[model samples]
Target: MLPTLRSLMRQRELALHLLTPEDALPAGALDAAIEWVHSSDLDDPTPFLSAGQVLLSTGTQFEAAPGAESVFAYVQRLRDVGVAGLGFGTEVVRAGTPDALLDACLQIGLPLFEVPYRTPFIAVARAASDMAAEERFARRSWSLGAQRAIAIAALRPDGLSASLEELSRQLGHWVALFNANGALDRVFPAGALAASQPAGPAAAAGADGLVDTVRREATRLLRRGQRASSTITAGGETLTLQTLGRREQLRGVLALGGSSELDQAGNEVVTAVIALAGLALEQNHSLDRARGQIRAAVLRALRHGDLALATSVSDGLWGELPAEPVRCAVVETRGGQLDAVTEHLEALVVEHPGRLFFAVDDGRLVLCLGEDGLPLLTELCSAFALRAGLSEPGAYSDLDRAMAQAEQALARAGDAVGVSEFGEIARDGVLSYLTTTDAGAIGRSVLQPLSEHDAAQHSELLRTLRLWLEQNGQLDATAQLLGVHRHTVRARIAQIEKLLGRDLSGFQERAELWAALLVAAE
Candidate 1:
């Protein structure tokens, strides 16, 4: 904290005297913070002075006996530039303090103090400079200490949430975190704020509105699908909202709220917290990827009839596997919503333990839940606007066949966002037969050219062809589902036909291509 004018006058060695009457002082004048002390003899020194500075002079710029109007003008100019106070050097260019100058300061509410000749202007400047330097040092030390505390908090078991709590504690303000779906994940000092109690600067502002506003901003940022930050005032307090993780894979949002604006030191502490939060989120993402791989491995074991291996791997980590007579469901999203949906599912899996199991396979989210958990599957699909294909309940040994059933059901859903059941569309037909191992190998060979082109050029030709087939060769529907122009869909289909050396317009060729797609999917 810088020394105010009242504090400066208390320095006995300087022999400073307050000329402004104690009773006549303006509001906050006694505690007016002085940023620095400067000396000048120029008539108009306001141009060189900044706000909150205390200007000292020897009265050299004034006439021998300046008039009241001239004195008032000088005082007004200083006040206009936000000078904290004026210090006149007595007995230097004059025998004593000028009456006109004193009168003008008193009338204009500008603080006026006297500087004795024994005290050089440099002495006042040095004192103010030393105080500012000490303040800077103290702030820097506090920032470093706060950053260390936040870092330590991030190492806790609940690292991400713990770091946020520490930041709120260090700043003496409220902090909240929101997941990518704009759902409130955690809040520090969780409750209503009371002004009389003084629970940090933002305590005066109600926490209810604070949280609502933060979540609203979080949603807006997520919808924008970009990495950015915004600051807003909620219930008379300032709140900062920042996006976490990369732009394409946003993890969540972090919000801090307080009545007063953060100083540079406080900002540095917040910046460190943001960085640590991001690191924790990225670490969790990596961990989630590893977990997904393990889940996928478990699923593969079940498909290969290795129940023992699957049970051993999943037993302690995710609870026991679902009992026999389990149903399989494969989910697919349009695009860009996969990360948010995956996060939601992860939370559910943690909350429910072994109630269900899930994994990411071939760009689709796959799940195996007990027959009783079927309602949850529907809820998930509806909530996330996803398309899902479900198979009838079967023993663990029949998982491979069940997967084909689910894939067939999903194919029946076409380009719509809803659930499709294998039992509803099952038939003893070519489609069902094509989903076998021998058929899959032939299908892969048939689409090998398109697959190679996609892998080498990083193109979406394969995806386009799949969607076109799903839409039953309808260009408009395929374009709408892919979020592209109809002409582009037509061109891709034309290119597919050329690569396959088959007329896509023919029913036999279309059926063959569709079967190949189903085989590859299984």
Candidate 2:
């Protein structure tokens, strides 16, 4: 809030008159803070003048036939050095203001003022300095007030959201909060802030594209876990991204949009918000860990067939379990990537509002999800390339049995199939229980006689028997599948029954042959 050119002009006691037209001055130059003021008669005073200062000169050096070009060069140099404006002293050295300097100031868009001889140069400098000090003190006071307000908001019932709301008000910008996973958790000003252009179809499309780009950049910055700030131009507005947390443990990010770069006071407020947000995130994480421990205990109690204890613990943490049957799933990562899989599942669970209990046990992830969450759990497993086994839907009382079934199904899941269900394994019966070596042995033993017979006699009996079994021992259907007549199929089945010394009509024999066929195919 240092004194600006316009503010100095308003001080009648200083007798400052703007030589340059108000409209001709550079945009924001009048409102720009004047760091200090200095007087110099030396040519090329730019070396001594700093940025954001009003340079006062008596044109003493210009008395010696100073040309317009020289005046232009001097003003250009002062402008290049970021001098806030040029103040030419009148009624001394040279009467009134010279035409060359006035033209030069107008051409360069630099603010120029005339200081009457009645007003000493020291007066203007002292005034600017005093105003700057006053503004500094005011800003400091305002910053302290904002910080205290934000801190109090953080202690309110709504906590972080209230703090964010206060921050948005102080900043005059939209604020958005993102979780650790880079997902947007909340936004201040709600839906009022949108990325969009003024009008036209092309502008609309461009706005959409820019919004997507900003979101991608924000997410990337959050995941990178670096304390950084970036300005993104989107929808004709500037958006700034700021990471919240300590250097070692990045917990979340804050996105501020619809505003320009923050000033000193604004930056101080942002720092406070970042610190508070970090503490809030840390507290939330600690709470989540405690809840997870409670959930783990509940899972263990359920596994031990202690339903009442499990129910009590679960109710205390995540409310009541679903009244409907719930399915238990056991998931195992392919490459010992438990952390990645667990994070993925946890994110999915957050999206699903229903009750879910999950924890890592014995190097595998176990979950008892609500029946409605089955599809999402399945999707998460498949997306993460995790091998999973799911048990049938069962009540909380049947938790132990469901877990056992899920584990058995997980063991049955071979490399070919990524996921297996208890019902599928149960349907496979004893064949599903066989290991690779055992199934191979059983397959060779049951089919070796027919295979040898076919090899020795060059008959199609094995193929015919497989087709017949696959067709559920239907003569006409098997014949059609084999592209042969029903009579030929019947003859082949009779030869197979005689060669195996077993009646194909018996259910036990048919079951055994079917199992052998399945094992051999595998």
Candidate 3:
């Protein structure tokens, strides 16, 4: 450690005497490292001074007994510059320390020391400089050892977790790793530190809120493809967040909490850890991409009824196929870009491991997850403002049918239903399947008269008839739905019956009209 005010005062060789009482010393004065000792007689030496320095002066500027005002201004300036302490050389311009200067130092809580005539300011400067150099060298050695330890830990079975544990131990601080999606991958010290909570109520509640704020900001930075570092004081601790990656390819984030800022040596170790983490993340991404490709191939094989080839392709990727049948889900964004949604789904796959097989076909995401995974899929859909179609749980050999069902369901998605299941629409599967066949022709012929009449007269007769049919020919219900009187609804139905020359009393006619209406709506 660099020499501090307390240490310098205790050095018998220098014979420095502490004029400031222990209580008068500024907070952290005992541990505040002195970068160097600066001796100056200038009226305002703060401009040439920097923080963490012990400023020595001979009081020559106060030879004329500069009043309390000048003394207070000078001391305040030194404090503003963050000088570690102020040293006065006595027995030169005045016999002892000035009462005004001492009072000023006391008022500002700046540590004050009296330098004896026998001990020159140059001697003090040399001693501080030497100690600082030694401390730097020691810190460098310690940091190098830590780097080696971390490297070895990275090679262990636990890999990144081991390395992070070693780092946490070296820093005496908590460390956490967050993936690109802002999900925590691992943390050092395990559960000892909650990023969202402090250890006691003495800590501010706002500090706990910082965890989510910092995480969101970090995630935004990563999404923008930028390297970022953020520092925030929370729970009286300095929390630092660093992005891990090269250039614009951000792969992860490292969060550290400590009482003090990291020194140069600590920064070096963190840099090494960041590099290692980036490489690991890249490797994992490559492996995931490869696995996705294999899964895609397997899905294609299954679609073609090539069960043997599909099983062979998936053998190494998944331990066993789901015995209880699987549901196929087709998801697509309504208007947003699909990339973010795809990445989120991929993260879900990572979380669930072998429970899901996913592939991006064209601009849509295709997922074959276990039957119980429907809730997760639903949540993803809601989160991403996505439209999803789910097929019924079926055998591996039935993937082609399931995929067709999923596609049909997806086509049927609308404002009322953002996610539709195949079973929910299977009753109308015949009409849906004949979309390009006789359904279109039948719909046009059945509703052509009403459509032409409405177009010419600017009337809503067809709409009224559809509402009437939907309401089970209940004039009151149809009239209420249309916000019209029952007489108006009866008149529209009478016109519809006359135009189609079909009786409104038969179940078969009503069913046929309903089918035609369904085809027309599609």
What Cα-based lDDT does every candidate model obtain? Answer: 0.84, 0.80, 0.80
lDDT of each residue in 328-408, candidate 2, tens digit only: 888877643554466565666556646566876665678887867777767866666677889999887787788899988
Ranking by TM-score: 3, 2, 1
TM-score of 2: 0.76
Per-model root-mean-square deviation over C-alphas: 13.3, 5.4, 5.5
Report the Cα lDDT for candidate 2.
0.80
Provide the lowest-lDDT 10-residue window in model 3. Answer: 334-343
Alpha-carbon shift of residue 460 in model 1 (angstroms): 51
Clashing residue pairs in candidate 1 (N, C-alpha, C atoms within 3 angstroms)? none
* Deviation in Å, model 3, residue 290 alpha carbon: 1.8
Q: What is the lDDT of residue 436 in candidate 1?
A: 42
Write out the backbone clash pairs for model 2.
none
List model 3 lDDT by residue over 231-307, tens digit each: 88765677788888776767788888778889889989988998888788788778767866776777788778887
Q: Name the candidate that leads on TM-score.
A: 3
Q: For each candidate, what TM-score against the reference? A: 0.65, 0.76, 0.76
Candidates 2 and 3 compared: the better one by TM-score is 3
Error of 1 at 11 (Å): 4.4
Candidate 3 Cα lDDT to native: 0.80
